[model samples]
Target chain A: DAGVTQSPTHLIKTRGQHVTLRCSPISGHKSVSWYQQVLGQGPQFIFQYYEKEERGRGNFPDRFSARQFPNYSSELNVNALLLGDSALYLCASSSATKLFFGSGTQLSVL
Target chain B: QKEVEQDPGPLSVPEGAIVSLNCTYSNSAFQYFMWYRQYSRKGPELLMYTYSSGNKEDGRFTAQVDKSSKYISLFIRDSQPSDSATYLCAMMSAGGTSYGKLTFGQGTILTVHP
Candidate 1:
């Protein structure tokens, strides 16, 4: 089975612009989570969605939002991008026991 | 202090040597401990996972967790160049929103020179 997959492998945006990143979870998986990994740091949880309902959210600001589709795919939308927002955005899908992650979308805010 | 503390070591070791990676966590409620390996520009994959304390071994890798000290370690035997990557330690609590959410350490970079 395929692992989690994310789109727009790379993206660049202006400081004040907006960005939307997409992720497709593995087949049969019903939970999806988003995390942000800065250049020299580990991934920080952003949001988690299960059964198309928001299950949990991290300390990120309201500008960062996410939603899960009926098919368990997810999208992370970040607005008012700042230079600090430049990082690799990772998407993970979970089963009962483990999480499968995608290669991630690299977003650069200039 | 961060909930999970890990030395961000660009730890370099010669091949066939033993490598040890460690993390100290502040959360006593965390019951599930996990280690992940991440290659450059890729997402992390689970290396070892254990519940509560005790040690678990797989192949040349061994994961040890000490709940009393709030410390966890990953040991690699006969390290090879392929083992070069960032090793991350993550933990999750037993109940509430934390159940599905994992708190991660900064990660230690390991490079095994051939």
Candidate 2:
């Protein structure tokens, strides 16, 4: 069975632009979460959705948003991107509380 | 202070050597401790997880949690070249609004030479 899959394996955008990254959770999973990992740093929590409802959010700014669909697929959108926004964006899915992550999308904001 | 702290090591070890990675957190409420491994330019893969304070062992990997010290560790026995990667420690605690949320450490990069 497929674990988790993310879209646009890589992405690039300019400051003030917007980018959306997609992810498909493991089949039958109900929880999907997003994380951002900058160069030389660990993944930082962004948001988590369960049953298509926002379950939790991290300390990220309002420019970062996400939504989960009925099928447990997820999208992470970042607006007004800054140079600092360039990082590896990861999506993780879970059947319970333990997370299974995808290969992730490498985002570069110039 | 940050909730979790980890040493970012460019630690080099020979194949078949034992490897130990560690993290410490200030939050006493954290109940779940997890270790994740990330390859270059990839997402983290869960390696070890332990709930509360205790030890959990999987094939060749052992995780230890000490609530008294607010510390957690992951040890790999008979490390292989394939075991080279960044090891991250994550913790989960109640945020007053959610049941589970994770805080991650900086991660340590390990290189095992064959």
lDDT of 1 by residue, B37-114 (tens): 999989999999999999999999999999999999999999999999999999888764665588999999999999
Pull out the clashing pairs in model 1: none
* Candidate 1 residue lDDT tens string, A5-108: 99999999999899999999999999898999998899999998889989899999999999998888999999999999999999988875467789999999
RMSD of 2: 1.4
Docking model 2 quality class: medium
Q: What is candidate 2's lDDT per residue for B1-114, written digit by digit as tens?
A: 888999998899999999999999998989878999999998889988888999999999999999999989999999999999999999887453343367899999999999
Positional deviation of A45 in candidate 2, in angstroms?
0.9
Worst 10 contiguous positions by lDDT, candidate 1 chain A: A92-101
The C-alpha lDDT values of all candidates are 0.93, 0.89
Candidate 1 TM-score, true structure as reference: 0.97
